[model samples]
Target: PAGAGQDQTFRADDEPEHGDLIVTEAGVLKVLHTPGHASNHLCFLLVDQQLLFSGDHIMQGSTVVINPPDGDMKAYIESLYELLAESVRYIAPAHGFLMGHPEAVIDFLITHRLSREHKVARALGALTPVDLKALTAKAYDDVPAAIHGLAARSALAHLLKLEAEHRAFREGDLWHAIHES
Candidate 1:
């Protein structure tokens, strides 16, 4: 039976390695590590049919957010590109049905992220001395208030990434655009 290791902040080294390849009655499946959603994220390739089992990476329904601290946005973007580079006609995701249009879904995801970055940029321009809570509120106002905390987390993820890239800076709980001098 499959198993998960002990809880650790990063990918634990103590985790067992379940062979690079798994051979079953179906076929020889190659394990592809697609870490983003979580450091443990994975995608499998069916050797016989060239089918890809996209577990939570390319869902058919709602787009999966690239949760940070553990899920790096940079890594997630790279992972998407890596998926596009692979040769596969069928995508069976963990959530929702099979993805009929993989390219379109990929494009949508990429564009969605870029759009969020733009929204952040616009938010930076319009306001001064905005805290994480306030900026996140405006940026993700469309989402229900109940889930605003999670939205704030995502927004903070963006802010953290932007800050690392020198595009933004944080003062206490607030984030301000670097150019506003």
Candidate 2:
């Protein structure tokens, strides 16, 4: 539902990198390059106000999707940890209402993602040599069946992270867990 290219008239006057500061009337905004939901995703922090503009990194109602290739689950988790180092008291998410206790919010999101990853690992251990679809069903059994398609995307991202950590592997369309001796 992303209306990409729908507004071709819009142009960026300046490209801000991570750690760059932009002075505005409200305050000095510190650019944070948070890549996960999208490779080019950025979050702006109002330094003086201790407010973070989370963009698509963190939403009010739902967890951000980490579709592969562009979306990296590992990077997403790491980015969340990075935010913990910042002095943010409130979060101004792009899709939700302003939230208080920024650290608590970040912690919750990280814990939730890691918990889901654990579920994915358990599912993989139980259903080794299984395809992505079957594995997603087992891992995301807690969620409604209607959204399994979307869940599969996140599951794949988790599997990729596991693979990077030498905890899982894939052969063709089937995935296998790497058991340590």
Query: TM-score for all predictions?
Result: 0.79, 0.94
lDDT of 1 by residue, 22-78 (tens): 888899887877776777788888868778899887787787766677766656666
Each prediction's Cα RMSD? Answer: 4.6, 1.9
User: Which regions in candidate 1 have their CA more than 4 angstroms from the true location?
Assistant: 1-19
Q: Scored by CA lDDT, what does every candidate get?
A: 0.75, 0.94
Q: How close is candidate 2 to the true structure, as a TM-score?
A: 0.94
Which candidate has the top score in lDDT?
Answer: 2
In candidate 2, position 176 carries an lDDT of 98
In model 1, the Cα lDDT at residue 1 comes to: 12
* Model 2, span 99-179: residue lDDT tens: 998888999999999999999999999989999999999999999999999999999999999999999999999999999
In model 1, the worst 10-residue window by lDDT is: 10-19
